[model samples]
Target: MKWGLLGGTFDPIHMGHLRCAEEIREIFELNRIVFIPASKSPHKLDAEITSFYHRAQMVRLAIEGNPSFSFSDVEHQRAGKSYSIETVEYFLNKYLKSIEIYFILGQDAFQAIQTWKEWQKLLLLCNFAVLTRPGYENMGLSGALPEEFSAQFTYDEKTSGYRGPTGHHIYFRKVTFLDISSSDIRSRVRHGKSITYLTPDPVRHYIQKNNLFQMD
Candidate 1:
């Protein structure tokens, strides 16, 4: 079976997250896409993150009806900072190397992957489907990729993707860019602005009921 793993803080899951996962599932013919909300992010350690319970619940609500979509709390269950390499390894062990795992991430995250823990090993472990943002559709390795790993990928013009040294490919998928962001939603809510369409109705209600992100 082929699976896609999308991990994030998911302070509050929104439409943008759902849309990206949906598009990738259809485009790649994936069996299922698991949305794993991180307990804590190493990159955003200083940033104020919502509790894991709320983040996980919001993810569950965001992907309730889709049979192909599911949520996992693997990171939450584990201790310490959530790292992609560890998560990928866990999935590999749990699936016993029988499934093809694709790590789904945005272009920004893809570009900063060099800073991640065991990034080289992570690249060799699974395929990457980086969702390209608007205006970054034609981006190449020179500016996007780190200097050290530039030679690792050989560009294939026919497919507009990059093949790694190992057989795993980094597929840069051009997604329909949504102007919405989790931080922006939080800011709006903090100022008492309506976040009706920014996130799902259920999620909005939960936030309101709990009074989350509201300024003191």
Candidate 2:
């Protein structure tokens, strides 16, 4: 089985998030796409993230009707910083060992892989699926990859992805451009700006109903 793992804070799930999942499902012929909302992201420590319950609920609403899409509370269930290596290990152990796991990420996030907990070990667990963000693809080797980990990558234009074996295997899938960001959405909401197209209608309504992001 081929599964795509898209993990994020998902403070409030948005259209870009949904679109990216859909696009990747088709592009990679994935059997399922699991949306994993981080309990606490190791990165972005300054941002005021919503509670795990709220974030998980928003993700549930966003992917409700899609059979191919599902939610995982793996990070939330596990204490401490949400690390990809741990999350991937959980699925590998609980689910089918023969399954192919693709860890989905944006180009910007992909560039910062070395900063993640057990970053090198994460590559050995699952393949990476990177979405093309504005100005990210233009970054050369130094910009796209870490100096110490450059030797691990093997590019394949046919799949628009990268592959490397580290005990297991990791793949980097280049996807369609989607500029949507949770930060932009949160900022708009905080400033009382319209977020109509930025997020899903249900999520927008949920945020408004709960009065989230209304802080001064």
Mark the 10 consecutive residues where model 1 has the least summed lDDT: 135-144
Candidate 1 residue-wise lDDT, 39-135, digit = tens: 8899999998889998888889889899999988999889999998999999999989898998999988877788999988898788899998975
User: Could you tell me the TM-score of candidate 2?
Assistant: 0.88
Q: How much does candidate 1 score in TM-score?
A: 0.94
Clashes of each: 0, 2
The TM-scores, one per candidate, come to 0.94, 0.88
lDDT of 2 by residue, 130-197 (tens): 67666766453357667667566665555544556453334444556567778888889989899998
Candidate 1 residue spans exceeding 4 A from truth: 135-137, 146-148, 157-159
> Which segments of candidate 2 are over 4 A away from where they belong?
138-148, 156-160, 166-174
